[model samples]
Target: MMKESLCEVNNLGLRYHRGESAILQGLSLSLFKGEIVGIRGENGAGKSSLLKAIAGLLPYQEGEIRMPKEVRKGLSYLPQDLSLYDSLTALENLIFYGKIQGIPGRLLKTRGNWLLEELGLSQKSREKLSALSGGMKRRVHLASALMLRPSILLLDEPTVGCDEESYHRIRDLLLKMKQQGTGMLLISHGRGELEDLADRILTLEQGKLREKCISSD
Candidate 1:
């Protein structure tokens, strides 16, 4: 049986400004439920642009991005910056995002604690983002992203600063999400990470997307 495609991008194109060379062109891909699609590219290859377009953060100049009706409301974006409020504690940060995602106070508290513990940040839960190490902050940011139980997770350089334990924890979490019928589109610089986690790999180069060969397990 074929799994449903949670995300579809057909002939997608994007540019920095009018008449400028396109950063991405004729890009097409689909993210099916329980699947992880890994994307690789050189700097300024439009990987980020592609994610932003699917996330509706950037306006595409051509083509379409289609999400399943059921998934339309359940998508999450984790950009390279891992945005978090510098002044807020890890727990406070998750709670803030949970509220933004419409999670009730009680549920937010429960899920937030679970995520922090799962990601190895429970002990630092009360530490402000400014005080946490880069890896710890990244983990906190990820905890916030998962707090809402999103159906599709869009990741851009999500493992940049993670240590071995945090890296393993995140990989496990992503797999867990896949088992739960979530689709993922991941942009990563680490070839090994992509090989271990991705069901398929794609590369963006010269303003187009094409299949990239990855070593088998």
Candidate 2:
């Protein structure tokens, strides 16, 4: 069966300032429903910039990105930096983000509870975000992103600071989401991580991207 395409980027080019070197150029990629595409690159590579462009956070000077209305409406971006308030509890943060997404109060409550339990953070749901460890905080941020049950998920280093258990839990959750038909673009520096989670892996270098050849062994 042919997979449905959720988004497409054609010949994308980006630069923060005029006359500066392009952070990304001539990049083209397509994401299919229920597919996980992994991007690997060094620190200075334009991986994050590519994601931001797709998320509509950055303005690109060249090329075009096509996302249908349904896909755009259901898109979610989880940046490398956690975007939760340290002053709010984990549950409170979820509620806050849900409201911002215009989710109904009752539905938000139900969804938030389920996400907390799924992430093994139900016990810490009411704990202030400032008190949570780095891994716990990352989980909370992830839960907030999942609040929308997005059709397209852009994850930037979702397991960067995660411990062994946390990493496994997240990996499992991502696979579950994939099974549920969520197309994802994940950014990571770890080749093993991508090999384990992504159906296709692409490496970004010098503002360009190429497919990574995996060993059959």
Candidate 3:
């Protein structure tokens, strides 16, 4: 069976200002549910810009990004910075984000607990973000995103600063989400994470996305 496509980007173009060089142009991409796709590129490449456009955080002048009316309501975005609250505990942060995502009050508690436990952060549930290690913070960040049971996830460098165990936990959590039918678009510069997580990998250069095979190197 063919999977349903959650997002469609057609002839996309992104520019900061009129009469300036385009940051990205002639880009098209499709994301389907129950899949993981990775995009890799060099420093100057517009990988982050592309993610911003897809998330509707940035305006695109010359293209269209279409999502199903029904499915549009359940998309989650995790930016590169993680954007977590530094002073809040992991549980508190999850509750805040769940509420913001419009999850029901009682349900938020249930989902938040499950997410924390599943991410192997049950012990750190009450730990302040400032107190938790880098890996635990990343897990908390991901927990916030999954709180609303999103159908698709947009992740940027999800395991960048994670320790070995934290990295495995996040990777495992992603696999679990995939089994339950969540589509994920993650960007990473390293090949190890992409090689293990991505079903399809693309390299972005000069505003173009080219499919690429992961090398053993």
lDDT of 1 by residue, 69-112 (tens): 76978889999987899899999999999999999887988999
TM-score to native of every candidate shown: 0.94, 0.96, 0.95
* Model 2 spans > 4 angstroms off: 213-217
Candidate 2 lDDT over residue span 76-173, tens digit each: 99999889999999999999999998888989889998988888988998899999989888888888899999999999999888887788778888
Query: How does model 1 score by TM-score?
Result: 0.94
Q: Highest lDDT: which candidate? A: 2
Each candidate structure's count of clashing pairs: 0, 0, 0
**Taking the tens digit of each residue's C-alpha lDDT, what string does model 3 give over 13-115?**
9888999888888988888888888999888788888888887788988889999876678888898787789899899999999999999898987898899
Worst 10 residues of 3 by lDDT: 208-217
**Model 2 residue pairs with clashes:** none
lDDT accuracy of residue 187 in candidate 1: 95
